[model samples]
Target: MASEPPDAAAASRRDGGRPGGLRRMLRRLTASEAEIEAEELQRDVERHGCQPARQVERGQLVSVTGRLRTVVYTPRTTVPTLEADLYDGSDVVTLVWLGRRQIAGIEPGRALTARGRVAIRDDRKVIYNPYYELEAAP
Candidate 1:
């Protein structure tokens, strides 16, 4: 890897001021040029339109705008799970907060945002179910 110049205004910088950090990482990841170009185009397009995100025929980005209708906390389990009933106004999503790092942070009725890939669990659609959690409202 080569060193990049110290000019902060030059553009995005990575590594030792080298040009290859982003490109090399992209190359190593085997990202397609068209995909990269599309991403760049998407970045430009992002400022002009609503954000694009992963959605189930059922789910959307877990944001603070959702309503909190339920919460369950277990105390006897080896690892606690914070189960939340998140409503996106139209319907509800059941999100599970697993692991001490996240499960410890959940609270009932707190406005939250959780972003993750959505999937069908127990035949119902959920986002951040096994992966999502209660994100503190900023």
Candidate 2:
């Protein structure tokens, strides 16, 4: 007849009465599939002698290869930009093509390599007008 403690009830509610729910919740909160993949990609890039996005320093010239995670067109700006996020398993760098709406073969889910100088704009890593090459289709 006694009411359950709020903390115990909350924990049970969180994990469906399953054991290690807290651990699972912590892992889910701390890591995502994208993040895990990024970490793995980082290792692979390093193993192959390429700099990962996270290891790229400001003003450093970098050549990074990764899959395009997103491609967005900003038409409302004074100078339109075609922005794409490239994730190489370690981190993501935003590639901005100024005065562009789109480029052939530069779409999301495509593998490509971008080479440019690293810069931080608005606290996000970005590479403007990066020279890009599409990876060979598998």
Q: Which predicted model would earn the best lDDT?
A: 2
lDDT over C-alpha atoms for residue 40 of model 1:
47
Q: Where does candidate 2 stray beyond 4 Å?
A: 1-36
Tens digits of per-residue lDDT, candidate 2, 1-138, equal 998799777877979989888676677679988776666667657665778787898899999888889999999658999999998986789999999998999999888888999999988899999998887775
Candidate 2, TM-score vs. the true structure?
0.69
Worst 10 residues of 2 by lDDT: 39-48
Q: For model 2, how big is the CA root-mean-square deviation?
A: 9.0
List the candidate 1 regions with Cα displacement exceeding 4 Å: 1-55, 58-65, 75-79, 101-105, 129-138
Q: List per-prediction Cα lDDT, in the order shown.
A: 0.51, 0.86
Point out the worst 10-residue segment of candidate 1 by lDDT. Answer: 45-54
Against the hidden true structure, what lDDT does model 2 obtain?
A: 0.86
Q: What is the C-alpha RMSD of each candidate to the true structure, in Å?
A: 14.2, 9.0
lDDT of 1 by residue, 1-138 (tens): 776565542435444546666565656469775565445434532443423322334455433224356778655457676667655433456676654334544566554555555556787656554443444565
For candidate 1, the lDDT comes to 0.51
